[model samples]
Each structure stands twice: as C-alpha cells, then as structure tokens.
Target: MASPLRFRRSSERWNDDRIIEELYSHLDSNLGARSVTPHYVGPDGFETRRFEMDNGDMALFTWNDDFAYWLGNTETPPALWRTSKYTFDEVPYQIARWGQRELLADLTVESPWLAKYDYLSWFFLPVLFSKDGRETSRAFFRKYDAGFPDTTRDEALSFYERFLRTGALDDYRYTMASKLGTSQYFDKNRMSSAMSEFTVAKLLTEAGYDVIPEIEVTTGHSLDFRADPRNGSHDQSSLVEVTRPQPPTQRAADTPVAALRETAETKSNGQLNEHGGGAVMFVDCSGFRDDEWSAVVGEQPDVRHRPAVVFRARPSGAIDAYKKGSVPLSLSQAVEWV
Candidate 1:
C-alpha cells in the first residue's frame, strides 16, 4: 500500500528558476495551488515552500544541491512525476530532517494541543499530523490515553513512547499510524482496537521476534501480525490475531473473565474461525488491574481456540503473560508467566 507520508525523490537537473516555474504552472493549473515566498532555508537548500491547494491539500517542496523532494497529502506534482518514492528513513538524512520539520510544523498547526508532548508528537507524526486524520488522531491520544483505561495519561503515553523510540514500526508508519486516525472520529472502541496492535507489537519484538503487520491470509482477511524469530534459528513464523477485551466495568459482561471470554469468543467465531486455526489468538487483558487479573489467571477460561495467549501488560515494561495450546514462539524472556 502506498502510504501518505512517503517522499518523492527527484534528481532532475532543471535549474532553480525553471523548476519553480514548472511547479507553479503544474500546481496552479491542476490544483489551483498557491504559494508565498519561502520563509525558511531548508537543509543545504536555498528555500523551502509550502503550497496550499483550493481542494484543501497542501504540498511541500524543498530543493537542495542537485536533488528535490516533493511531499504532501496531494498527488505528486508533474515536476516530480516518474520519480521513485522513499519512506522517512530511506531518504537522505538532511532531506529527512527537513521534511520532518515541515511535517511537524503542519501537525502543530492542526492540533496545537499536542505541542507540549515531545515523544508522542514525534512517534505518531505520520498519522497525528496527516491531512485527513490530524484532529481526530490527536484527540485519540490526548483524550483516551491511547486506549489504556485506569492508567494515568502520562503513564500511558510515557510507556508507549519508549516502545516507539525503538523504531520497531517506523517502516510501517503510514499504515500503522493512520489506523489511529481514519477510524470514525473519536469512536473509542474502533480507535482503541487500533492501539491494541501496537501493544502486541511491543510484546512480540521484545520477545526476540520480528513482528510484521497486516498479513493477508487466504481467507481474504488480514491477520494482525506475523512473528518471526529474530534469530536465524527458526525457519517458521507464527501468525497472530489480537483481540482486546473491554475492561469489565465498561462492558455488558459483569466480571473481568466474563467480559474477556465474551470478547474472545466473538473473535473465535468470526475471523479466527474463517481463518481455520493456524494463527494464535492474542487476548490483551491489559486494561485489567492486579485484582481483576488475579481472577482471570485463576480461571484461565478457554478463548474457544487452540494456540491462544492471554496476558496483561503495564506501561513500565513489566508484562505478565501465559500461553495456551502449545504456542511455537518462546516469550518467556519478555514475559513473566502468571
């Protein structure tokens, strides 16, 4: 999938004057894009300009040395047409830095409430600052604590910030980050469900496995993740489908175990059932506290599937989890078995 945040790299040798004229002609003719004089000198460049289109799209162009980069929510301009695109990390460092600064500026402009958070701002830059999702994405984190209930906002943000800093999902930023945004605006359940994938990612990588997101199966459904052992030891990978049960207090099920069982059963009958059982089901009970988890651990109710793992995680890198039905991956290093 082409992500919204990728950059189009151009090595065309058009002189500076001709380049600007061509861009202006193409943009103005096609998108009614208008620009003011560039106010900043980008990395190794004479100027960087932001163009606003009549269709509510914004594009940024920065020229430095012999190369130019085009980035925006809009389609690539004719000037950068036929150029190969690169992700944030795949571009030159200076280009990446300048583009990030431009993107960061857009984010701050759209959601000033996020201006104070340094880590959260950088980690979700792609989605939180994206043209379509800027407002909704910021609110998901700002108001919902990124979907962690019973935890302070600071606690939740700080925990996830550390995980993101590791760059585990950096390559999949557009697809993963935008998931938080493109949901129904401020729809808590859908938005929280998106964050559960990230939590599972943190768990899988910490267990010495590489987690690949959005794996498509023959059933025409995308499983949440594919965990391959990071070491060269394993030739096989494990498919994982994650389900996060709403905390007991907020759901129809009166008890924590009852709520989890209900949620897991629903998943077991749906996607996993259609998948026909190779994937492991991950039940994220992170919303539960110590007392709530104690009842769950004692019962360890069947999730109606084989190769399922049930666990709770805290933001401080402390995880208590257990496996059922012979899970192939070894997670004992990252998780303390309950």
Candidate 2:
C-alpha cells in the first residue's frame, strides 16, 4: 500500500499580497511567458483597476468564499481559478498562485489515483484501467496524501515521467466511454435512466419485495435486476426481470418468451427450492404499447401459474392500467423508500 497524501488546512490571516508576490516570483523563474496578469473581481462584481499584476501569463485572483466568512468579514481573498480539462464546461477555482490551470491539468493526468476522490478530472480512467489490467494506481493516490513538499514533488514527478514512458495513460484513456455527444440533453437521459431504476427498486421494496440491481448472479451472467426473499421468508422470495424500452417498434410474432419461461422455471426449481417456497416471474416495465404487449403475450405459455406483468411507467407518476392484477408503479408512487 502507498502512503497517503497530506492536505493543508486554511491558515488564519495570511498576507494575500505577499503570497501573490511569492507566486509571481516563482512563476517568473519557472514559467515566464505563460503567466498573465492576475485579475481581481470584487464583491460589488466590479474589477479592481490599480495594483494589478500583468506579466503575460493569464492569472486571476479571487476571494476564498469560506475564508471570507471565517474572518467575520464579507471580503473574499483573491485566488487563482481555472477551467478544468476533465469535465465539460467545468471550471474549478483554487488558492494556488502558480501554474493555475496548467498545473491542475498536469497533476490530474499524471496521478491516476487522485482522480478517484474528485479533485478535478474524471476518475473513471484509472478505475477502468484497474479493472482491465492488474496495475494499481491506488498507491499513487496514497502518496499524494503524504503532503506536497520538495521530496514528494520529486517523487511525484519521477512517477509521472515513468508513467508517460510506459504509455499506461494511453490504455487508460482508450477504455473510457466517449465524452463526445454528451450534451445536456444526453445528461438528462442518463439521469432519467438512473431515476427510473431507482423508482423500480423503491416500488419493489414498498410492495414487500427485496430488490437488488445490477447483480452478477454467476461469473459471467449478470441481471439488470432481481428481487427476492419477500414476506420474511427466504424460501418464499421472488425474482423480477426489468427492461427499458427503446422507441416504439413492431413486435415479432415469435418473441423470446419460451427462453424466459425456461430460465424462470430452472431458477425456481433449482435456486428457489433451497429457500423454501419462492416463485419466479418476469416484470416488463418497458413502456411498450398495448399492441406490443399483446404480441408478447401471444407467444407466452397459457399456464396460469407462470404469471407475467407488463406495464408502462411514466415520469409524471402515472402507471398504465394493470393487466390481470399486475400493478405498474412509478417514481412518485414509490417515494416511500427514498
């Protein structure tokens, strides 16, 4: 295991002018032309005219919101804020005087483990890398927790140089899902999908069922959902299979109902039998229209024991009429669990 990184607490009553001067001196020696004049935005939302430092490198000094409150004054400290390279249109502000945006991006990309706890960049890269390869970046993050000092800086820089040489970062980036086409609308879709899943889980819980989502039943076989152990009886639990419907489509005359039936029967007889008196049923909340539902029902077995429910769930808390006592539930109706 790697050592943890140390974080500094906010100091009381620090000299902002001296800090800025030190930062300027450091940047002038290290990164000259890339530095710009520091801009200040005041409480009145007006720009301060005089005493501004402009040396070609773009720098901004803004007040720290928390520190302003702690001082028993509303005046904020001038700090450096920059646009984040990790998130789309996300600009994160920090109190560092040197290497504002450039340093932020460099540190994030260099240290994959720091990505896990939400410093700035997307942490999913390292996560995917670990899942695919055995290399552990967790140690890198642990070292970051040790404190940013001279020795730590050298160590971190060395690690970054070696990491770059190995081309490990390339693998990390390739495994991540495309961030393109992820507009606000697409974000809304993801949010809706998550909320919909939560709603279904909540409904099952309220209806006296134990629900588990994204569970891996076997080594390679995972289910989108499963509900079990209802009525306080482990043997009397039930299983639910959920599906999210896409745009309307004509259902084929021969659906995969037989496959579903066979699987359900096998699970009930094999796994459920061990629990006591559990049953298996399919619950399709795929928002299919009546005709689509009829087509699926036509292919299912006529046996009454194998009961299936098909219903459409709307975001506005409305559930279509239940078919044969199978109830359709929505988010609002299932809020009790949340």
Instruction: Highest TM-score: give the candidate number.
Output: 1
lDDT of 1 by residue, 202-225 (tens): 998888889889999999999999
Query: What value does the lDDT take at residue 71 in candidate 1?
Result: 75
Give one digit per residue, the lDDT tens place, for model 2 in 136-240: 233322433111122343443343333234332233232221211122122322322333343445455545555655445543444445666565644444444
What CA root-mean-square deviation does each model show from the true structure?
4.2, 18.6
lDDT of each: 0.78, 0.34
Top-lDDT structure, candidate number: 1
Model 2 bad stretches (over 4 Å): 1-196, 229-235, 245-247, 250-286, 289-308, 315-338
Q: Provide TM-scores for the models.
A: 0.78, 0.30
